[model samples]
Target chain A: MQKTALTRRTLLLPAVVILLGLSIFPLLFSLALSFGDWGLGRGIPYEWRGLSNYAALLADGRYRNAAFNTVLYVVVTVSIQYVLGLALAWGLFLRPPGGRIFRVLFIFPMMLAPVAVGYMWRLMFQSRIGAANFFLAALGFEPVRWLSARWFAMSVVMMAEIWQWTPFMFLFLYAALMNVPTSPIDAALVDGASRFQVFRHIVLPMLMPISIAVIMLRAVEAVKILDTVYVITHGGPGNTTESLTMYGYNVGLQYFNLGYAAAIAYTLLLVVVAIAIPVIIFFKKEVSYT
Target chain B: MIRLNSVQRWSLFVALVLWAIIVIFPLYWMVTTTFKLRADIYAGPALIPWVDFVPTLEHWARVVARYQQVTRAMANSAVAGLASAAAATFIGGMAGYGLTRFQYKLGFLRNRDIAFWILSNRVLPPIVLVLPIFIMFRTAGLVDSRAGLAIVYTMFNLPIAAWLMLEYFKQIPIDLDESAKVDGATYMQILTRIALPLARPGIIATFLVCLMFAWNEFIYALILTFSRAQTLPLVVAGQATQHGPQWWDIAVMATITIAPLLLVTILLGNRLIAGLTAGWGQ
Candidate 1:
């Protein structure tokens, strides 16, 4: 019979190969491209421009707007999603009538295409001929142009994100809630502590690790947001809701400026990595706790 | 334990139901709007379907007939998602087997490092590498093709699959594989016939989870394809702005995209939950 070591190596190599090919190769390729000035049209050729691309993004109004929008959207949406998600998790744990079916219902949005979700909202948010405005008029408020105005359009985009991702937070927080030791909660209850006190003093503290994990994870993901916003407003009104990825797409694919686009994409990666490192550390601690 | 009073319990129930309805209304709105006519969907503050208007299948039929890419894109997404997930699961299962069943030492890095290295791939966002991958695909003539997209998704999903399967493999007792080996079964045979079969539920969960991700993917498909290899999500995104999106039609398209996920949710509820907590929920 053949040795197990050989079998293990053979078995493991494909995954290693595919992972490296996908990640490291593109990482290096993008890293190299980021340092050059390359474009297709107007007879522009690949020329060395060390740090120029990164430096240029500093003063670009559009890039700054995208950066600001990305930060604003992530902060607003992640905070709303976390609060709602935790409350929903607590609600689910309470097991109200018909709660089981709702668990299934809640996750459907998170699973559907973000693009599809965006399209549904886009239809709903249509200015004159849409259901959202129809309700606004019914409520005695004037019909507002949701996607035509920068603030409203961005709000609409964030709404789509919050609507879709809150379920994700719910599922994770709910799972963590299940894992929390019941001993502390039971002791708090037997001590005649109030419901809010029991939760705040014991349960919430117990859930802190998971809360941090979930928040950090979702925060990292929020920074990478693209598909939904792309469909909802296409970074529109005046680049108000534009994200780093959207801008990169426009520059790289639409504008055919590969080098600068690569730089933009690299910046996105760096920003995400900065946030993700702490998350990685948290999970590592979680591993030891478990 | 303190008993919740009727008033408290009832209020809690109401609050829970309200929360769930708020969560579920968009999907309900999508379905109801699909059945409503263009004028009705456009004109309405009506949230309820039966009370709002009579439903019709005209838009549903038109979604198929009008957008020729509707069916094609769905099929493309299926192929890409299913194929990549299957590949990822198979390869990842083997890798998981390697990680769980055997030990290896490499220079300066151990097996744990390799596993985490794979895990690290999952953390990077799709758009970061889309440009470089697009350039590579362009040079290799692989862009806008199903195989190329599947390959991308395979890499996209393989890490999670491996991580998940590694956990699954640990749960399964190693004695069975050891016994099978004692009976002269080869490593491949034991893996195929023993470990894999025992972990079938986890594998299925992993496959469905990966399939959900690849199928729902938008940006990669957007950048990598023009019209030929567009996935359903890409198609929906593209057609949403075309000719002033017919809400009814968009709803129909949206429904088609959501239906499979709903089925997966219903059929594999526990597995789906497991996959979500398995980390990298999308």
Candidate 2:
């Protein structure tokens, strides 16, 4: 028994050490740094600011704009992806012709790097010689500038996000749907329940757990939207498409305002934790009830 | 189960086909653009090879001409991804096994809290840690090194690896461990000789997922590495020049960037799905 206890500690030590050294240390350092003023490019000594950075962030218009954009982007993209993914997964559950081929193909977009996906969509949406405009021209319509306008650029970024991640939702939910027992559905159908009624009553309630889990996962990731926006718009049209992480990057890396950037980072962390807690609690309750 | 009527089935087929086109068209364009002449690419959306425009190897030739840089980036990505995945799998597999077989109490933190704490590392945004890590790496003179990048990737991938392996390990009967214990097998011996081998598929799935994340990771690679240790995503992103993005060149590089994982997805789609959805039901 003593030997077993020793071996267990030995097994877990490496992960524990690495997490504390690499992850927790940096997080704590950043948290402390958020309260001080230091700029790498400005060549200034560290000075304690006592929440001034946070105060500044509260009043910063660009920061507020970025916060708003991040919320809008996460809400729009995740909701659309969830709805479309559920529909597609349900269709596949019906076993359409070429279902296997479609499954593989649908996953292809997700396999590519987000940076590559961004560039691929950038090529498609290029104004002068791109496919989107070319098709518009072919149909005798005026070509629209895709990346120059605020809403258009935001839509393009969101579309790229949805295209890449909807497959993720579909893949998980499809697997869940496959595992769902058929006996209940059959029993309900035999009891004279209509298809829609059976679906709403039986299938959806069965799907609730996985659905919430997938959405929560997607929402958490969507809140950190950076790579696509970085490649696609660079937060262009006057920072209209800038996500919170993008703004943090600009503040920390570009301007070298490490203190303020850390504050922004902590704010993002708070946002994520806030979003995660309620969903997780609801998930726990649903799982227990089921 | 409620069966689909013929009309419903036909409409579903058409819908799937339409969505398939939407999904495939962008990828089709990416590949086709690699073979098109600049004139043809800018002239219009010439989608077909033989019908709309003549295909050429000029872009491939250009990418090949910069073979040194491209290949170096590819090698860096492969090394970092594989090393981190392997390390994370080994360590996280052990951690997972320990969590399952042994009870750990650290203050108010039990096994479940420990597991969630590890998993929460993933939930933290990379941007938040990028600067401090950058500072630390700079101080240690590890910036722009593949090893440094691998270390960071390992930290991030550990949560995923540990969580997946924990779920996978849970599926195995604890009675096996107990029986092995009665046979005088130490915990290490049981983990290595019995549990790990039994959980081989899960380990591979975990490794593949970690590799995919490391391979496609960009933000850290963007800030940490400049040129020497730059990964494939950076190479793809660097295709933008002062003049403009070279469409054909970007297409070729992006294709190379995306190909390996695409191959992995095609080959191990089901296992990958299983790994990703491991604990969803719970």
Candidate 3:
């Protein structure tokens, strides 16, 4: 009994310490930094300012634009990726003779590094000699100047994101589809249910767990997107794609406004948590079964 | 036993085939473009690289010529990635083991709290940590160092590491641990000899997940490191220099940066899928 107690204590103690060191410390440090005059060039001398950083952000147009960009990014990317991913998974789930091969081909984009994808797509989107423009002219239409225009720049960034991550969401949904019991689909078919009806009534309901998880995971990631924007536009075409992560990076690292940057970072944190908590709650309920 | 009507089957087949082409085309373009000379690339947007053009090794040669920085960056990335994987696996394994093996009395630190806290940490946009970390690392003289990058990556990776390992450990029956204990095995002995072996697949999955996170990481690498410790992405991004962008050199650099990641994606394709599934569904 004494040995059992010692063993238990040994196991529990290290786990607690690890969590405190890794999780708790970072959160506390960030909370403190958000309230101070932290900047890049000059070191932050331990001075406290209450809510001033937050106040400034609330009154800043750039912050508002960054927030809007983040929301637009998360909402558009998640919705498009989810809808497209589900469609692909549904098409792939049939286990056709070449299904394995098709699945492999589908996930090809997810394999490349995001930076590489950004570069490749950036090359393809170039106005004068890009493949996208080259193809457009071949088809006898004026080229769409993918990166030079604001709306088109944002759209191109979104395209790069969807290109890379749709595979991820597809993979999740495919696995979920594989695990879903087939009896319901069979029953629906026997009752003369159309394919769409079968999907709506049976397959989608079962795939909801996986769909929710994928959306939540991908949404949080999309909200803080940086790589493609950084590599492609550098948040350019006049800050159309200046996401909060990019915004915080510009402020803290480039502009050297640590206090304002920390506040921007914190607001981003709140938005991420606000979106994630409900999905996590949903995930817990879903995962309880398997 | 044909289940679907012919039209339905063929429609699905056609759709899959088309999208597969669409999905795979860009990747194919990247690989093929690496072979084409400057003139050939501009000649037309033909998918076939077998056209009338002399394939040159110049691009590959240029990438190889800068081998020192490439090797250094690769080393920095590998050290950070593998070390963080090791550390996260150890820490996460311990926490996972404790939560699975013992029922602690702290209501605030219950299983749900542990899982939720970890998940929330991951969901926190890493931008939130940048200011504080810059300040903290600047003070500690750890900025622009691989160790600092590793610590930051660990913070980013630990939450998912813990969550995955927790689910993985829970799936293992406790009776195995009990049986090992009954055979007079120490906790360390059981962890090393029994649980570790049994959890090999999960460990591999966790390691790959950690590696990909570390390797493909750009934001932290950008903020943390200057020229001294630049990784592959930084190198590729540097192609867009002050004297206007060199398209050929940028393409060559991109090919280098993407090669390893693509290799991993193909080689560990199934494993990467499995790891990603575990991260998402569990």
Most TM-score-accurate candidate? 2
- DockQ-based class of model 2: medium
Q: Give the per-residue Cα lDDT of candidate 1 at A27.
A: 84
What's the TM-score of every candidate structure? 0.95, 0.96, 0.93
Expressed as tens digits, the lDDT of each residue in A1-290 for candidate 3 is 78767777776565456556655676677788788875446655656898999998888887798789878877988899999999988887765557877776678787667888887778778786577888889999897878878788888888888989999888889988877777878888888888788888888987777787778888878888888888888888788778888888888888887777778888878878887888878866655411
How would the candidate models be sorted by TM-score, starting from the highest?
Answer: 2, 1, 3
Off by over 4 Å in 2: A279-290, B241-243
Kindly list the per-residue Cα lDDT of model 1 for residues A41-118, writing each as its tens digit.
Answer: 557867889999999999899998998899999999999999999998887776666777777877777888898888
Report RMSD (Å) for each prediction in the order shown.
2.4, 2.1, 2.5
For residues B110-175, could you state the per-residue lDDT of candidate 1 as single tens digits?
Answer: 777677778889878777778789878987999999999999999999988998887778778888
Predicted complexes: DockQ each: 0.56, 0.64, 0.55
Clashing pairs in 3: A38-A258
True contacts kept of 1: 0.61
lDDT of 2 by residue, A181-212 (tens): 99998998888998789778888899987888
Q: How accurate is candidate 1 locally (lDDT)?
A: 0.83
In the range B156-176, model 2's lDDT, one tens digit per residue, is 899999988988898888888
Higher-ranked by lDDT: 1 or 3: 1
How high is the DockQ of candidate 3?
Answer: 0.55
DockQ ranking, high to low = 2, 1, 3
